[model samples]
Target: MKSALSAIVLLSLAAPAAAQTPSDWRTPDPENILVVETNKGRIIVEMEPNVAPAHVERYRTLARKGFYDGLEFFRVIEGFMDQTGDPQNNGTGGSDLPDLEAEFPFRRGASVPFVEAAKLPADNAVPQATEVGFVGVVPVRSAPSMQMMISVDGKAPAWGLFCQGVMGAARSNNPNSANSQFFFMRGPYASLDGQYTAWGRVISGQDVVVAIKTGEPVAPPRDVMKSVKVLADIPAAQRPKIQVMDTRGPAFKALIDKARGADGRVDPCAIEIPAKIG
Candidate 1:
């Protein structure tokens, strides 16, 4: 009888420990993964075309053509962002390509995968607020699920939250002036959410991003992106196999609950999706 009780206890402990075995993780499409080899270190960004299709295409096109190689991070503001993708190693220059239109407040259909982490209370400014969650690896703020019933289409509005490691395109005062220049956020800045175009988020080497030289215009010895390419463009043998924790899986749901604690709420930016590169 005592032996049976011990076996049951051991099995319970082993179950959660193995919850994230191979099946709970998803491999990002190689074509959608941006590999930026900077002086600081290599950074991996997983592009979400479903949120900003045009922006992702622009990044992939330029990266494949070697347009971003050797571009210096000229405007690196500590605790803010590390800016690069300029040809001249200055804040002013960009690729010869035409500017891109702003991509914000992207609409999402029912088919889009979303795992809600926490719900926000309605305030005076937001009469009918909703929950915050992750759509793949990107943190997002989405409309209430019930909104689908009243909408013309079955889609609802959603936008990516500006969490740490989130990537946003640099633009001039004009809303549509985004070009080659972009920045990797070192910390969360909610003001940029509805304004700038956020195309992706860093999956690895965020430590390298924050370690970058800090200045409004980094002095002569600025860090440079030695090379940039889509992961699929790299030779098969040389490319790293990257996998991220699938938020839809039970393991991630358990993590969300653990993060929420007794309050039953969590800061969206505080949740991190684990990633592994092999």
Candidate 2:
């Protein structure tokens, strides 16, 4: 099923060349940024703590401990995803931390910086009709604010979408088993939406994520992440100055408009949020 949509997914994420003034870019919080130096190249990820707080905290704790360095991409599939973060280098190891509960179906309050792309009808899976859009660089499906009026809490439920470049926690059949292993999506896969915890999205290096050598077992000499560090942890002189297109700004609004299809609905995964690293 996924293979059939591979071509379309790739094409949809193709960002048009846009020259933006310096004001269009915004610097991400260093604490929420990750610099993944892989054998292929540097990949920058902007994590959304608001979406999956526990998952984001776990990544930060493990990264600060240097637990992610030297881990290899053990399971990579073309047009799918790249799974890594196993100390055993074969997907059977994790940090000693206890497992975490699933973080999806989070609450999306009115204050969240959500840029709506399209509205979706309610379904069995999501009882409330939802609006799909980008909350910063992360694609999300959220119940409309109207749902908040009668709710016990004042916020509506929302979850991250498994869009291209999204980051998801790898878990066993048990939904809460995610510990240290995670994957970076190579293409959009909606099936994983409520199944795994999505904590962030790659703001840069979608090319390098897809360029990872593809294999279920990824034979010897598999690509490795040489170092994974929180941006704030890197030395001031050594850190790569980074900026992502402001999702709330007109430039990103234009990008969102450009991604809309004939039906005027945007494929959350089809967007390639632009970034710059200096």
Candidate 3:
């Protein structure tokens, strides 16, 4: 009987160890992945077209024309974000493409795959989403339960959250003035919530982004993107197959469980899952 009890303990201990098996990883969708090669290093961004369709379309068109090749990182502010994509090599320049309207407060319904958490996070409350989960390896929050009632059509609203490495369109005084100019967040500032349009976030190489020069928006960037391309648009031989930890997998759930919160509650931004490129 004692030996049987030992066997039970061993099995219990092995369960979690085996949870991190082959099923935990997921290959990213090449269609939405963007690779930006910079003098410092590479930064991978996962585009969320559903969040901002027009912006994604504009970006794809610009990238196809090599509009970002040899572009400078004009505006870089430390402890905030690194802004670029301006053609003038300064804060004021963008593709001839017309400005995209504000896509904030993204409404959602059954169309989107909202991989929701068990409950609302005790930490940050955006007042729109009740729980957060991963959508295509990008951290996204889901609409509150009340909105989920319209789950069949997703007519309700659900906006994406801004964690570290999140990317958004930079605009002028007018919220609809967002053009090709964009920025990468080095830190989290909830004040920007629902103010700017966040279409994607970095899936890898946060260090390279951090290595960029630090200063005010007018400060010149030490390193600039050598080239930027959509993974699908790149030559088949040159394209990279990248994968990230499936946030819906048991491993991710374990990570969520083990993740420590800043105020004794799990801070979603605290968890930074990596993307593997092969």
Candidate 4:
């Protein structure tokens, strides 16, 4: 079966220019782009400040300081996530920076652009929230009424989904204990939906993430992030220009229409709108 993207991208391939134009795509900002190179390959992450600004800032600070370079994935749990960024190379370590207050377990109002595209009032199949959609390319789950109960800056409550490649902070039992340690989701974990703060997601090179060396938690001789740099930190000539399929664009609309036309509901995860990097 053709993925929703495969079907639309095939049509886009026939009309390359229309699909390649600026309006149809969004180039991630250098400051917001994270470039991670492991022994396996490069993985690109697009930071989302809208959802968890503090966590994003912490990540940016750590990345700029080269805090993550040479750090091993100290904890890799199969079917859960790959945890890293601990300077001590174990789950016990953290950066000099202070721990961030929990930004979630609260409402993020529905003012986000993608929430509108979610067709919220119609029906959302997501069990975790009344509405579900993408914030850019990052999947999010939220409740419209919860957003209404309490909203910040006209935005409603929405939590980034713990789907494949979702980047989130690894906290102690305390919700606010999140510091430098973070994890990349290897698969879906709906149980984590509203509890953690997800600052970004892998836009490409996810295969490398799936290939991350896995063993017992706290195991040694595991895979490591050989070098981690912000796309802006890298030489301009060497940086990759990443463009995500415009959720607001007609191409995405057609894709959704096709998917919804055939199936009463669309699996948001199955839509597969990947970023195009050049």
The true-versus-predicted C-alpha distance at residue 122 of model 2, in Å, is 3.4
TM-score of every model? 0.89, 0.90, 0.83, 0.83
Candidate 2 residue pairs in clash (backbone atoms < 3 Å):
none
lDDT of 4 by residue, 1-278 (tens): 00000001111113233355668777778898889999888888888887788988898889999999998876676767778888877677888888888777434654555533354443343444456666766677666655575555655567777777778888887788888888877776767777777778888777777788886564566899998888889998898877787777876766665556343555555565646777
Q: lDDT of each prediction vs. the true structure?
A: 0.78, 0.81, 0.68, 0.70
Give the CA lDDT, 0 to 100, for residue 211 in model 1.
91
Give candidate 4 regions above 4 Å deviation. 1-21, 106-111, 116-129, 145-155, 261-264
Number of the candidate with higher TM-score, 1 or 3: 1
lDDT of 2 by residue, 34-120 (tens): 999999998888899989989999999999999999989988988788999889877777889998888878888877888888888
What does the lDDT read for residue 276 in candidate 3? 61
The candidate scoring highest on lDDT is 2
Clashes of each: 0, 0, 7, 7
Listing every candidate in turn, what is its Cα RMSD in Å to the true structure after a full C-alpha superposition? 10.9, 4.0, 11.4, 6.6
Give lDDT for model 3: 0.68
> What is the lDDT, from 0 to 100, of the residue 66 in candidate 2?
98
lDDT of 1: 0.78
Q: Write the per-residue lDDT of candidate 1 for residues 1-278, one digit (tens) a residue.
A: 00010000000112245255888788899989999999889989988887788889999999999999988888887777888887776666777788898887778778878788988777663466877788777778778877888899987887877788888888877778788888888888877766777788888888888899987678888888999999998999999888877779988788678779576777667766777787
Check candidate 1 and list the clashing pairs.
none
Would you list the rank order by TM-score, best first? 2, 1, 4, 3
Candidate with top TM-score is 2
Model 1 poorest ten-residue lDDT run: 1-10
